[model samples]
Target: MQKHSSAIWTGSLKDGGGSLTSQSGVLSATPYTFATRFEGQNGTNPEELIGAAHAGCYAMFLSALMSGAGVVPDRIEATSTISLDPTTEGSPTVTAAHLDVTVKAPTDEAAIRDFAEKAKAGCPISKLLKAEVSLALKIA
Candidate 1:
Protein backbone atom coordinates (compact mmCIF):
# COMPACT_ATOMS: atom_id res chain seq x y z
CA MET A 1 0.00 0.00 0.00
CA GLN A 2 2.32 2.68 -1.23
CA LYS A 3 1.19 5.95 -2.79
CA HIS A 4 3.43 8.59 -4.27
CA SER A 5 3.29 12.23 -5.21
CA SER A 6 5.97 14.33 -6.88
CA ALA A 7 6.65 18.04 -6.68
CA ILE A 8 8.74 20.40 -8.77
CA TRP A 9 9.78 23.80 -7.53
CA THR A 10 11.59 26.63 -9.25
CA GLY A 11 13.16 29.87 -8.04
CA SER A 12 13.82 30.95 -4.45
CA LEU A 13 11.99 29.61 -1.45
CA LYS A 14 9.74 32.58 -0.85
CA ASP A 15 9.21 33.42 -4.50
CA GLY A 16 9.19 29.93 -5.91
CA GLY A 17 6.08 28.21 -7.20
CA GLY A 18 5.62 24.50 -7.68
CA SER A 19 3.35 21.85 -9.11
CA LEU A 20 2.30 18.65 -7.39
CA THR A 21 1.37 15.47 -9.18
CA SER A 22 0.14 12.24 -7.68
CA GLN A 23 0.33 8.78 -9.15
CA SER A 24 -3.40 8.80 -9.73
CA GLY A 25 -3.21 12.17 -11.51
CA VAL A 26 -5.68 13.75 -9.10
CA LEU A 27 -3.24 16.56 -8.43
CA SER A 28 -1.58 16.78 -11.81
CA ALA A 29 0.22 20.09 -11.92
CA THR A 30 -1.71 21.43 -8.95
CA PRO A 31 -0.05 24.72 -8.11
CA TYR A 32 1.39 25.65 -4.73
CA THR A 33 3.41 28.68 -3.71
CA PHE A 34 4.82 30.30 -0.60
CA ALA A 35 1.72 32.46 -0.37
CA THR A 36 -0.50 29.44 -0.47
CA ARG A 37 1.36 27.81 2.38
CA PHE A 38 2.28 30.79 4.52
CA GLU A 39 -0.12 33.56 3.62
CA GLY A 40 -3.37 31.69 3.02
CA GLN A 41 -3.40 32.49 -0.67
CA ASN A 42 -5.60 30.76 -3.20
CA GLY A 43 -4.04 27.36 -3.88
CA THR A 44 -3.40 24.00 -2.31
CA ASN A 45 -0.97 23.62 0.58
CA PRO A 46 0.53 20.69 2.42
CA GLU A 47 -1.59 21.15 5.51
CA GLU A 48 -4.76 21.20 3.47
CA LEU A 49 -3.73 17.99 1.75
CA ILE A 50 -2.99 16.35 5.06
CA GLY A 51 -6.37 17.42 6.39
CA ALA A 52 -8.06 15.94 3.35
CA ALA A 53 -6.29 12.62 3.73
CA HIS A 54 -7.03 12.46 7.42
CA ALA A 55 -10.69 13.29 6.98
CA GLY A 56 -11.09 10.70 4.25
CA CYS A 57 -9.20 8.07 6.16
CA TYR A 58 -11.19 8.60 9.32
CA ALA A 59 -14.52 8.42 7.51
CA MET A 60 -13.67 5.18 5.76
CA PHE A 61 -12.26 3.61 8.88
CA LEU A 62 -15.38 4.51 10.85
CA SER A 63 -17.61 3.03 8.18
CA ALA A 64 -15.65 -0.19 8.22
CA LEU A 65 -15.81 -0.41 11.96
CA MET A 66 -19.54 0.10 11.95
CA SER A 67 -20.08 -2.49 9.23
CA GLY A 68 -17.95 -5.04 10.97
CA ALA A 69 -20.14 -4.68 14.02
CA GLY A 70 -23.24 -5.32 11.93
CA VAL A 71 -24.33 -1.70 12.25
CA VAL A 72 -23.98 -0.24 8.80
CA PRO A 73 -24.31 3.49 8.78
CA ASP A 74 -26.48 5.47 6.43
CA ARG A 75 -24.03 8.33 6.24
CA ILE A 76 -20.73 9.47 7.67
CA GLU A 77 -19.46 13.01 7.44
CA ALA A 78 -16.00 13.81 8.76
CA THR A 79 -13.74 16.81 8.82
CA SER A 80 -10.13 16.77 9.92
CA THR A 81 -8.48 20.01 10.93
CA ILE A 82 -4.72 19.88 11.39
CA SER A 83 -3.22 22.39 13.73
CA LEU A 84 0.07 23.72 12.40
CA ASP A 85 2.26 25.81 14.62
CA PRO A 86 5.86 26.91 14.57
CA THR A 87 8.29 25.00 16.71
CA THR A 88 11.08 26.46 18.84
CA GLU A 89 13.50 25.66 15.99
CA GLY A 90 11.51 27.87 13.59
CA SER A 91 9.98 24.92 11.79
CA PRO A 92 6.37 24.07 11.18
CA THR A 93 5.00 21.23 13.25
CA VAL A 94 1.69 19.44 13.31
CA THR A 95 0.64 20.03 16.88
CA ALA A 96 -2.73 18.37 16.80
CA ALA A 97 -5.57 17.03 14.69
CA HIS A 98 -9.29 17.53 15.40
CA LEU A 99 -11.69 15.19 13.75
CA ASP A 100 -15.37 16.20 13.66
CA VAL A 101 -17.55 13.33 12.66
CA THR A 102 -21.31 12.98 12.15
CA VAL A 103 -22.82 9.59 11.64
CA LYS A 104 -26.33 8.56 10.72
CA ALA A 105 -26.76 5.07 12.00
CA PRO A 106 -29.53 2.83 13.26
CA THR A 107 -27.91 1.85 16.49
CA ASP A 108 -28.09 2.50 20.20
CA GLU A 109 -26.15 5.36 21.76
CA ALA A 110 -23.84 2.94 23.53
CA ALA A 111 -22.99 1.09 20.35
CA ILE A 112 -22.34 4.30 18.44
CA ARG A 113 -20.03 5.61 21.10
CA ASP A 114 -18.21 2.32 21.28
CA PHE A 115 -17.70 2.25 17.51
CA ALA A 116 -16.57 5.86 17.42
CA GLU A 117 -13.98 5.27 20.08
CA LYS A 118 -12.67 2.21 18.32
CA ALA A 119 -12.43 3.96 14.96
CA LYS A 120 -10.73 7.02 16.41
CA ALA A 121 -8.04 4.88 17.97
CA GLY A 122 -7.76 2.36 15.17
CA CYS A 123 -7.60 4.70 12.18
CA PRO A 124 -4.35 4.16 10.29
CA ILE A 125 -3.78 7.88 9.81
CA SER A 126 -4.20 8.46 13.52
CA LYS A 127 -1.45 5.97 14.16
CA LEU A 128 0.82 7.55 11.56
CA LEU A 129 0.61 11.05 12.96
CA LYS A 130 2.58 11.64 16.10
CA ALA A 131 0.55 14.67 17.09
CA GLU A 132 -2.37 14.58 19.48
CA VAL A 133 -5.62 13.46 17.87
CA SER A 134 -9.03 14.46 19.22
CA LEU A 135 -12.30 13.15 17.92
CA ALA A 136 -15.80 14.60 18.31
CA LEU A 137 -18.59 12.36 17.23
CA LYS A 138 -22.24 13.27 16.63
CA ILE A 139 -24.92 10.70 16.09
CA ALA A 140 -27.97 11.44 13.99
Candidate 2:
Protein backbone atom coordinates (compact mmCIF):
# COMPACT_ATOMS: atom_id res chain seq x y z
CA MET A 1 0.00 0.00 0.00
CA GLN A 2 2.02 2.87 -1.31
CA LYS A 3 0.70 6.29 -2.32
CA HIS A 4 2.47 8.99 -4.26
CA SER A 5 2.19 12.59 -5.28
CA SER A 6 4.09 14.61 -7.87
CA ALA A 7 5.09 18.22 -8.30
CA ILE A 8 6.50 20.33 -11.12
CA TRP A 9 8.36 23.54 -10.43
CA THR A 10 9.67 26.22 -12.75
CA GLY A 11 11.98 29.25 -12.37
CA SER A 12 14.00 30.45 -9.36
CA LEU A 13 12.95 29.73 -5.78
CA LYS A 14 11.64 33.14 -4.81
CA ASP A 15 10.02 33.86 -8.18
CA GLY A 16 9.10 30.29 -9.08
CA GLY A 17 5.82 28.37 -8.87
CA GLY A 18 4.73 24.77 -8.76
CA SER A 19 1.76 22.49 -9.25
CA LEU A 20 1.09 19.42 -7.14
CA THR A 21 -0.90 16.37 -8.08
CA SER A 22 -1.86 13.51 -5.80
CA GLN A 23 -2.34 9.90 -6.78
CA SER A 24 -6.00 10.17 -5.81
CA GLY A 25 -6.51 13.07 -8.25
CA VAL A 26 -8.13 15.10 -5.51
CA LEU A 27 -5.38 17.68 -5.92
CA SER A 28 -4.89 17.69 -9.66
CA ALA A 29 -2.32 20.24 -10.62
CA THR A 30 -2.95 22.41 -7.57
CA PRO A 31 -1.00 25.62 -7.69
CA TYR A 32 1.56 26.76 -5.12
CA THR A 33 4.04 29.57 -5.21
CA PHE A 34 6.66 31.21 -2.99
CA ALA A 35 4.19 33.88 -1.97
CA THR A 36 1.54 31.30 -1.28
CA ARG A 37 3.89 29.35 0.95
CA PHE A 38 5.92 32.01 2.73
CA GLU A 39 3.96 35.23 2.40
CA GLY A 40 0.59 33.91 3.51
CA GLN A 41 -0.96 34.54 0.14
CA ASN A 42 -4.12 32.69 -0.82
CA GLY A 43 -3.62 29.10 -2.06
CA THR A 44 -2.17 25.88 -0.72
CA ASN A 45 1.30 25.08 0.63
CA PRO A 46 3.23 22.04 1.85
CA GLU A 47 2.64 22.85 5.52
CA GLU A 48 -1.10 23.16 4.89
CA LEU A 49 -1.10 19.84 3.07
CA ILE A 50 0.85 18.19 5.87
CA GLY A 51 -1.54 19.61 8.45
CA ALA A 52 -4.52 18.22 6.54
CA ALA A 53 -2.91 14.82 6.36
CA HIS A 54 -2.11 14.85 10.06
CA ALA A 55 -5.62 15.90 11.07
CA GLY A 56 -7.31 13.38 8.80
CA CYS A 57 -5.06 10.55 9.93
CA TYR A 58 -5.56 11.46 13.58
CA ALA A 59 -9.36 11.46 13.22
CA MET A 60 -9.47 8.11 11.44
CA PHE A 61 -7.08 6.48 13.87
CA LEU A 62 -9.12 7.81 16.77
CA SER A 63 -12.27 6.33 15.25
CA ALA A 64 -10.62 2.94 14.91
CA LEU A 65 -9.44 3.07 18.50
CA MET A 66 -12.92 4.05 19.67
CA SER A 67 -14.45 1.17 17.72
CA GLY A 68 -12.04 -1.26 19.29
CA ALA A 69 -13.19 -0.04 22.71
CA GLY A 70 -16.89 -0.20 21.77
CA VAL A 71 -17.30 3.54 22.09
CA VAL A 72 -18.77 5.12 18.99
CA PRO A 73 -18.04 8.75 18.35
CA ASP A 74 -20.54 11.16 16.82
CA ARG A 75 -17.76 13.43 15.64
CA ILE A 76 -14.02 13.81 15.81
CA GLU A 77 -12.90 17.20 14.60
CA ALA A 78 -9.14 17.69 14.51
CA THR A 79 -7.11 20.69 13.43
CA SER A 80 -3.35 20.42 13.07
CA THR A 81 -1.45 23.66 13.32
CA ILE A 82 2.00 23.46 11.78
CA SER A 83 4.58 25.95 13.00
CA LEU A 84 7.39 26.85 10.63
CA ASP A 85 10.53 28.61 11.81
CA PRO A 86 11.49 30.63 8.75
CA THR A 87 14.45 32.24 10.49
CA THR A 88 16.25 28.95 10.97
CA GLU A 89 20.00 29.12 10.34
CA GLY A 90 19.94 27.92 6.74
CA SER A 91 16.38 27.04 5.73
CA PRO A 92 12.92 27.16 7.22
CA THR A 93 12.10 24.29 9.53
CA VAL A 94 8.82 22.88 10.70
CA THR A 95 9.06 23.09 14.48
CA ALA A 96 5.79 21.78 15.82
CA ALA A 97 2.39 20.40 15.02
CA HIS A 98 -0.35 21.07 17.55
CA LEU A 99 -3.63 19.25 17.29
CA ASP A 100 -6.77 20.88 18.58
CA VAL A 101 -9.46 18.23 18.75
CA THR A 102 -13.09 18.05 19.79
CA VAL A 103 -14.70 14.69 20.26
CA LYS A 104 -18.45 14.16 20.53
CA ALA A 105 -19.19 10.80 22.06
CA PRO A 106 -21.27 9.06 24.69
CA THR A 107 -18.24 7.71 26.54
CA ASP A 108 -16.38 8.75 29.63
CA GLU A 109 -14.08 11.73 29.22
CA ALA A 110 -11.16 9.82 30.67
CA ALA A 111 -11.56 6.97 28.19
CA ILE A 112 -11.85 9.34 25.27
CA ARG A 113 -8.82 11.29 26.37
CA ASP A 114 -6.80 8.13 26.75
CA PHE A 115 -7.78 7.01 23.28
CA ALA A 116 -6.99 10.45 21.86
CA GLU A 117 -3.52 10.44 23.38
CA LYS A 118 -2.92 6.99 21.98
CA ALA A 119 -4.14 8.06 18.59
CA LYS A 120 -1.91 11.10 18.68
CA ALA A 121 1.06 8.84 19.17
CA GLY A 122 -0.15 6.00 16.96
CA CYS A 123 -1.22 7.83 13.84
CA PRO A 124 1.09 7.17 10.90
CA ILE A 125 1.43 10.84 10.02
CA SER A 126 2.24 11.68 13.62
CA LYS A 127 4.98 9.10 13.58
CA LEU A 128 6.33 10.40 10.28
CA LEU A 129 6.80 14.00 11.39
CA LYS A 130 9.96 14.92 13.30
CA ALA A 131 8.38 18.00 14.83
CA GLU A 132 7.01 18.08 18.34
CA VAL A 133 3.37 17.06 18.49
CA SER A 134 0.94 18.30 21.13
CA LEU A 135 -2.78 17.77 21.54
CA ALA A 136 -5.53 19.74 23.18
CA LEU A 137 -8.61 17.58 23.48
CA LYS A 138 -12.12 18.81 24.23
CA ILE A 139 -15.09 16.65 25.10
CA ALA A 140 -18.44 17.51 23.59
Candidate maximizing lDDT: 2
C-alpha-based local distance difference test score of model 2: 0.95
Worst 10 residues of 2 by lDDT: 130-139
**Residue 8, candidate 1: C-alpha displacement in angstroms:** 1.5
Which regions in candidate 2 have their CA more than 4 angstroms from the true location?
131-140
Compared with the true structure, what per-residue lDDT tens digits does model 2 show for residues 1-140?
88989898999999999999999999999999999999999999999999999999999999999999899899999999999998999999999999999999999999999999999999999998955757687785
Candidate 1, residue 100: lDDT: 93
Tens digit per residue, CA lDDT, model 1, 83-109:
888554677887888999989999988
Quote each prediction's TM-score: 0.88, 0.91
